[model samples]
Target: MEWLPHAQRLAREVVRPESRWYSAVATVPRHTYVPRWWEADGDVWILRDGQSNPDAWLKNVYKDTTLVTRVDTCHADTAGIEGIGIISDGTPTSSSTLPSLVVRMYRHAMIADDHQILVTTGTGYGTALACARLGSDHVTSVDVDEWLVNIAQDRLSLMGERPRVEVCDITGPLPGEYDRIVATVSVPRVPVSWLQALRRGGRFVTTLAGTGLILTADKTADGGAVGRIEWDRAGFMPTRHGADYEHPADDVWKGAMEGEGEATSTSRYPLLYPPDAWDVMSMLALTLPGIDYRHSQDGDTRTVWLLHPDGSWARARASGFLDSPAVHQSGPRRLWDELERIRHRLNREGALPVYGAQARVDPEGTLTLSRGAWSMTVN
Candidate 1:
């Protein structure tokens, strides 16, 4: 099947025709990088083989949509043709990010002709796009999974491209200095290794784990960095040290799901899924880091739970869209009250302080984000 026209259509949808990145998006065969992928079906994952349905493959591959390539330890490629309808109990580990977002990220990097860039190698599609914009010699892609690196390298080789593909953890020491560092994966904080590996005055763009923040900063002469949280927001899976993410114990989830709380009250607002609202999620993440969110529904009733590692928990339930939830809170902090406070602030002030906040990173990778008189630090 002819896929060039579809790629061109995607390019037009993502970037201007006059944009320098246009040709790369217009020409690269995205289908080659993603011959198989995993699609979400309610609570389980359904594996898709492109060869099985060429039309569906072209329809999906050329669109501006993210395609999940790996779920936990299960890769779509390794899954057999009969792997359709496979029930996956794990979260998405890697994916071919949507084309528009990839272009936006590269635009944030302000990559120049001579700039040497380090990017994430998820499905190799993003890396391929980078190589298309800058020569293969100017791009380097890295991943924590050796298999991913090896396969990405093989795929790139098929296109007569040989950018540096390595299997080192991105959070650890990098192999070389770069003019720009762009990560599609989110990190807890600015990795110290990234600070050291970026040349002075170099710029890096990344998102923080557990928040929809796009932090773009530059290296400083003093060995630290200074920049700001961008007005644009994005979210990515957090960096993993191994093949799979370390999930909270089942017992911990049970407690958050079923355990009684110390306090109960009527919530100020209707039941809202915090994560569905980017600003609310970001503000909550900034105020209370590592808070886990869970939701469940039974017929007419809907329940949402917020769990923090600090032993704080909040449960809210409602039956209607406009119904105020009965909120229960427990532990050292009143998690629900804090969430309400953030919402109240947004409702009254019109915005959260996290957007376009000034950012400063100490030499040790500590980040301080301040807006107006509000300041928060992440170490």
Candidate 2:
């Protein structure tokens, strides 16, 4: 379609022409792979088809935006008109990640010529770009969903590019070893199997689950890996073992948000959700894992909820600008106080050292992170 040239031109604006990947981004027909996809309008998800609105479809594909192709296994390709429109009531399960972010991850990989690579096959748009830059023979892509793998393989074949696409859980045994591994999916921690599959001296890039931190590290001789967190931030859906993600028990969620805590106090700082602040969010997630954050607003009243699986939950509510938050802490730990402590520590230092920090993974998936005298571990 005529969209290729326009997409190439648009990509040039974001991905420099001098970049080795520019040509691949310029040539690959991304719209074909996302002929049907979901787009969120307000709080509802709506389906958009290339054949129905070719112009809007072309505009979307060429804009370097992510296209949602699947919602909890209800593939857009097969979704029929339901309710009043073509919509699905499922959370996004897979998408063609934004092209700019896709290339940005590749840029972090610092891939060298002749380096064999393994990458996640989301919508195959990124895989097509990779195959165009590095020959199909040197690139291997995988996805846990067999249907996605098959669709991507066929699409890539139609484009006259062929990469070994496999259906396998990336967290488990890899299809093969390579010098570079880049994942668009977030992992809770560095998977030990990745350590086993990576060739010594090979490097990998990924985002930690529940945060925007992007990490890149090389395999070490001790079956561990060490690297630095990139200053740039990116977030992705965590890899799914099945069609949907498992949620915390309904009662656990209810208690965390509504139940009373053992200790009640006022917060030094106003209520804030950790995910809103890139600087402290990663630090919070790394230091204390398994905390789910939620934010709600009622007029001037803003409430933030921090719920943990261990029956520990914190709720902070504030009104107006910069008002002190009424903090409630219950269960085994005081989470709101912990948030204040973390924020205070970072505020005292002028900035958190998450960027350019040294990251080390032990043999069993324990991540030891340190920058200057500040250090934290996540298992």
Candidate 3:
């Protein structure tokens, strides 16, 4: 099994040539940690096991792609045997994240030869890579899921790169202080505890929840950090407090899908999919936190939907590519108008001002993002 060589080649394409972690990326066997995984087949998720299909498994494992190892509380390794088509639905709770993105976050951390770092332990593949690069003594990995921590600890011990792998809530008190902190999971905002835990001059990197906005900052003497959102994009699942994430109720889902209208209007532009346009999406996610978005298209017709926790829901549809969508919104707030306001600014500015913009985290955990005169706060 010369999968190591193929994995190394994939690394060269994703990681910058100057990265010192290249050897770590090359040496770690990603497949060992993700022997069985879940992948979507049409609308259903199918379990893929390596023992039954080693060749296809090897090919998928070597490529820079996320492998879902657990759905809710079900670990793919223990779920069943080869190619089980699960007709039921389960949200993905854990995965071996794409290697390129993990390395990107590591590079963003500006890891030194001596700096201790704390990172998330997903399937333990990333922890293994970090341990190889920074040595097990300098690496401390934590996760909120006890099962994840237990599984990752056993795997890391097998590789002989055992660091302090703990089942600690990453949003809560950390097990120890470190010079660098990089999280694969997105947080609502920079945790106040993280600032207290970071050594002075320590750097932190993580994404903002609901958007692919990756923020990095250095710990300041004022107890808050300052930095800019990188032009590079990255995203991961939100941090959960329990075995599974909270979802909207069945009635709520129905209302969000097709609720009665409070206000209605013609859209100014073609209904845009937020994920397709990152800048507009960033502004939308920041301005309107907890907005659930969905989109679909059929031939020439396109549809967009928005749902807010405040009982606001919106649906817009366009008959042609260039046509403006007719929007029908329900609930307290006009969600579609918010999107238009962001889209209008994006249309005028030619770029969302998130990149290279100044960001400040106050001691109380208020995050202020400013560019030129435009400013927004997340508290």
Can you give the TM-score per candidate against the true fold?
A: 0.97, 0.94, 0.95
By TM-score, how accurate is candidate 2? 0.94
Off by over 4 Å in 1: 81-85
TM-score of 1: 0.97
When 2 and 3 are scored with TM-score, the better candidate is 3
lDDT of 2 by residue, 1-379 (tens): 5887777786787788889998888888988788888888855788777888888888888886788888766887777544334444567889999999999999999988798999999889989989999989989999998889999999999999888999989888898888999999999988887888889999999999878899898998998899988889998989888767776634457776766668888877767788889878877777667778877888999988887777778888899658988887787878787788889987798888787789998778788778889787877
The residue-level lDDT of candidate 3 at 52 comes to: 88
lDDT of 3: 0.85
Q: Count the backbone clashes (under 3 Å) in each candidate.
A: 0, 1, 0
- RMSD to the true structure for each prediction, in A, is 1.3, 2.0, 1.8
RMSD, model 2, all Cα superposed?
2.0
> Which candidate wins on TM-score?
1
lDDT, candidates in the order shown: 0.91, 0.84, 0.85
**Model 1 residue 269 lDDT score:** 96
